[model samples]
Target: MSDKKALNFTNWDTTFDNGTSEDGSRNCVYMSESLDYKWVATSCVEKINFL
Candidate 1:
């Protein structure tokens, strides 16, 4: 549930959605490539973004 910046990359920025997802099933946050890499909430468990 943490992010890259939390690991010491201060200059980096994370673009999150307006808020958590309305769908109760989607509780995880991920970078959306279709939305220009903005952080979007989803239930996906296969893809993992790393620093």
Candidate 2:
């Protein structure tokens, strides 16, 4: 029911991409060029360092 989605496979929870559930605690998602421009999810308060 939320916009939390993972465009790429993650070592963390997979529900973000499956849309099966919404993780209110971690509401941040971004695309990673290293992973072929796939999406990654994390906490909004955390800094995303990708190159």
Each prediction's TM-score against the native? 0.34, 0.42
Question: Model 1 TM-score?
Answer: 0.34
> Which candidate should be chosen as best, given lDDT against the real structure?
2
State the lDDT of candidate 2 residue by residue for 1-51, as single tens digits: 277785664554333453323344556777766666666675676676756
lDDT of candidates 1 onward, in order: 0.54, 0.58
Candidate that scores best on TM-score? 2
Worst 10 residues of 1 by lDDT: 9-18
Reference-based lDDT, residue 50, model 2: 56
**lDDT tens digits, residue span 1-51, model 1:** 356454542321245443444543666666666667656666655468667
CA RMSD (A), model 2: 10.0
> Which pairs, if any, clash in model 1?
none
- Point out where model 2 deviates above 4 Å: 1-24, 49-51
In angstroms, the error of model 1 at 38 is 0.4
